[model samples]
Target: MTAPIALHGSNISYFTGKLENYFRVKGLDYTLHAMKFPGDGKRIERELGVYQMPVLQLADGRWMTDSTKIIQWFETEQPTPALIPANPAVAFICYLLEDYADEWLWRPAMHYRWYYDEGAHFAGRHLADEHLGSLPVPGALKRAFMRHRQRSGYTRGDGITADAVAGVEAIFLRLLEQLETIFRSRPFLLGERPTLADIGFSGPFFRHFALDPVPLEVIRQRAPAVLEWVARLWNTRASDCTGSEPDSVPTDLGPLLEAIGNEYLPYLNANVAAVAAGKKRFDADIGGVGYRGARYSRYRVWCLAELRRQFEVLPEAARADVQALLQQHGCWEPLWQEKLLPLLPGQDEGLPFRASTKMVGANETV
Candidate 1:
């Protein structure tokens, strides 16, 4: 008998939605332990050496955080209704798309959640305060929280303004347009069955954009097709991928992953760089105001860091595939020469800030 899997998470978290989808797709038996808004969730995460929701406690007592890591574990352990396409090319593409969702989409989503609406803004703050019991009182606590929030505040980029919001909105619209074009032909992003890419993108799509009242309305008005797709994906009842009983790999996925790498990923990478550069400029000029007021530099940095770490873990041949994709997308130069290289110029000891293609495995040091 296998030990039961336990999930510690919140209902409203987009990342949690990602994990839920994984459980459904893999047909894994698991139980969710919903934590109190900020308190219980934060406590468990801190003890486990992570700072986010959707943490997985395996039967063997091994704890995992981050949706990407959890998904990879599922792929290795379950290997059915394959989340990662069998073809190296397609699997790599799925990884890239997943990265985009986890990184790029987070900023705009956070911005809308905390900044656009007053009700949500206050509600989030109160929740945080309550979660941080004995930390401080209301007034001073709010100030401290704001300072901490500014460090990871999601924004269009380093500095966000009303104009920045508009710019990010345009990017979202463009992405929606592309997705609508593709989804019009196929039900899922990859094809008949949902792949890892679909699960990754859906997490944020459902949480911040679809469920949140303010952003939900925005998505409905601007991108009805995307909203529809979200509904279809979430409402799916199938236990596993077609033709796979317990665990079966999809056979025909090369074309889909190649298309993602060749056509979609470049666009996604450019968008991420633009947001990061723009936000950084915004913050430098405006000075640190508050989390609500400052640009979301730290969040962007964290996203990039995760990507770099993943890249390091790929096999050598696999790394080449990613590099080829990055080069074709025009990302190789800007990501290394312009943005990343300058960050850790003199530091050669730790992971340099610049992005590079390296193969890392499950046992490889990060």
Candidate 2:
């Protein structure tokens, strides 16, 4: 037997939980270990050229980063009981949903986790004990530092000001309702079986939405079916599933696509504009919410570029179908809104092995 993969990251981290869910469902042998801060961060930077969660260390001593790229690499190595659908159009949709879940939902997920006192306190204490226990600082100080750092970098500092709080929370609530409707009828996002779409969403749901106190209560009270999906996905193993792969995207998923069209793509366009203007922060009114001083991300600029690249690689027929679908939901215009994406040289070219930029700030120690 081969040595178990060494998965290093915080137990409660969003991306770590996402990779853990994928590894569990794929039946890959792995062991989870807390990424000791300061030390681990420096080491990971040396190995992967970036400090990020859920870095996978192979038996041969190879290190991997970026949960999305890591999963894609694994899927290529093991295609049976596929996590990504086989059909081209369906697979494209899965990729789209995955990207939406990764970049768009992150705002609300971060807001819910760090904006509320209930969530901040819970996560702060857990992270303090899990990732910072070896430190000589007092536990209370560690917890306090965690809370302050998270709020500073992720929630308030990122753009969830008091005025934007309700709007951010509404995003999560609306998501729960949409997902509840979908999960009420099917066991997975695409169909009766799990797919890349489910795995992508697992990033937010498995760790933040389902684990955070305030959002967990809201989920229990408003969208119990979604709550059940959180547990069901964690318990599911893809090798055991006998369900047929979905040949097409479901109609119920139109709402989610519509949300991406209306809310997410426009935001990406705004970010693209911000990056082009060489601004570190820019304010934009997204989904009727006026956000001031929202930090711009070059990484998200690459996300939009990557989405277009995926579309470009699809077959002719699949591209036609995808074009219609995206157009139907108002995604086509903004998706191609930036005629020339301001991509930095070699940006994101070394994914899974190296990183040119991070999803957010790179100074997150704990």
Per-model tally of clashing residue pairs? 14, 0
lDDT of 1 by residue, 1-366 (tens): 146678876556678878887776566767887655446655654555434566767887766666776777677776765767766655656676787676556655666666654425543665455444445457556645643463234443234566566655544565676776667666677676777888888877876777766777777777777888888777664454463321222233333334344333443344344454654322322111211233223334444555566667777877787677666654444344324411322222112111121211111112
Specify the highest-lDDT model's number.
Answer: 2
- The C-alpha TM-scores of every prediction are 0.67, 0.97
Q: Model 2 over residues 158-232: C-alpha lDDT tens digits?
A: 767899888888888888889999999999999989999999999999998999998889999999999888899
Q: What is the lDDT of residue 206 in candidate 2?
A: 93
Q: Cα RMSD (Å) per model?
A: 8.3, 1.6
Candidate 1: residue 165 Cα off by (Å): 1.6
> How many clashes does the backbone of model 1 have?
14
In terms of TM-score, which candidate is strongest?
A: 2
- In model 1, the runs with Cα more than 4 Å from the true position are 1-4, 37-46, 118-152, 155-158, 237-240, 243-327, 335-366
Superposed by TM-score, candidate 2 places the C-alpha of residue 106 at a distance from the truth, in angstroms, of: 1.1
